[model samples]
Target chain A: MERMKMLEWVQALCFVVVDMELYLDTHPCDEEALAFYRDSVENYEKAKRKFEEMYGPLTAVKSMDCERWAWADVPLPWEGVR
Target chain B: MWTYERKLQYPVNITRPNPAMAKFIMSQYGGPDGEIAASMRYLSQRYSMDNKKVAGLLTDIGTEELAHMEMIAAIVRQLTKGCSAEELKESGLGEYYIDHTGAIWPQAAGGIPFNACEFQSKGDPLTDLFEDLAAEQKARTTYDNILRLVKDHEVADPIRFLRQREVVHFQRFGEGLRMYQEQLDSKNYYAFNPSFDK
Candidate 1:
């Protein structure tokens, strides 16, 4: 997949996790919701790892894997280049 | 506490640079009905909310507003990127250019700096939730106006998403209000401030 496309997929997966988190916050003991959230989190982590390896660090703390400070080199989220 | 998420809720990849559109969209970043105000209002109000569910709603929605704020900033930043100084000036962005130089700052389209006065944390759940409902509608209206002015699909797409969120938030706040009301004597729902008087 293209870099942007991969990044977007990671984004969509993460958003699902976040939205599920909000629902789970209100319904904390719902077993079905917990299962769904766990599944989404697993998928999101996989996608995030793929994107970070190919592109660059998505978070400041995750920049340790790069040989260089790729964080500074990557296009900012606001620049709309990534 | 909040975790730092590095992606926008929706994507904004504007291929064209339009400083004029950027100016207008900046309002959603810092205007009276902007995300900053929405986040501030809810986050602050949560401290005094009478019910756990209502407080949870405030906290979650407030956090989402922060994300929306970043989304608006992304849109404005992308819109203004790669524009010439002459084009910026002609687009009536000269005053803003002098200060921020295409860098995003929290300000309304008219250049008014973001102020806390734009929102309220009334402390009373009923009062605060009503304000929240009104705030969401006002924000939706602002987004509607933005949609009317913005023609770019890239820009409008995210704006539409943000606008839809306002509608959803309004419904949630409405439910929050109903929840709070149900806890009170129907004849005397306004009997006292549940946040303080108990």
Candidate 2:
């Protein structure tokens, strides 16, 4: 998958998970929603892993653990990185 | 309790530098209705919350507001990127440039410095939640104003996303307010602040 397209997917998926989180915070007793939230998180994690593997690093820790200082190489989020 | 992420909530790819747009967008960064104030309001208010659920909501929402703050900062940074000193001066950014010199600072479009006075904790759930709800709307309105005047699609795109997040936050705050109300005595809902009155 294209880096931008994949990154966008990860961002949207992460949003869904967090939105459910806000819902659950207010409606803690909703079992169905909790289940869905877990599923969404699982899906998000998977996509995140794929993006990390292809695009290199999303977190500072991931960048540090690598053989090189990959963090400085990639275009920053503000660069409207393509 | 927070982790750093290398990317923005939404991508910002401004092909053109517009100091004019950056000036307005910076308000959302440090202005009164800005993301920094929004985050501080909720994070500070959560401690006094009697209900755990509402407190959690505050924590989560407060954290998200930090991300929005970063997004706004990125927008301002990108917009101001490569802006020549003369270009900045012509765009009414001369005073700001003289002070910061190609760096970003938290201030209103009108040049008011970012101040804690923009938000309050109140220590009362009702008062705090109402303030939060209003904060979201204010931020949303600021974004609306940005969308109306910003001609660049790259700049407008992320502003649109941030605007939508504000609406969602308002809904959550409304729900959180109800959760807090449920824990209060029905007969004296807004009569007093249980945390403060007692």
Best by DockQ: 2
Per-residue lDDT of B1-198 in model 1, one digit per residue for the tens? Answer: 876756777788888888999999999999889999999999999999978888998999999999999999999888888888888999999999998887888999899999999999988889999999999999999999999988889889999989988987887788778877888899997888877885
What pairs collide in candidate 2?
Answer: none
DockQ of each: 0.48, 0.68
Measured by TM-score, how close is model 2 to the native structure? Answer: 0.95
- Cα lDDT of model 2 by residue, B2-102, tens digit: 88878788777787899998998899988999999999999999999888888999999999998898888888888888889999999999999999988
Candidate 1 clash figure, as a count: 0
DockQ, candidate 2, comes to: 0.68
TM-score, B chain alone, candidates in order = 0.98, 0.97
* Candidate 1 chain B weakest ten by summed lDDT: B2-11
Q: Model 1 residue B135 lDDT? A: 98
Question: Lowest summed lDDT over 10 consecutive residues: which window, candidate 1 chain A?
Answer: A18-27
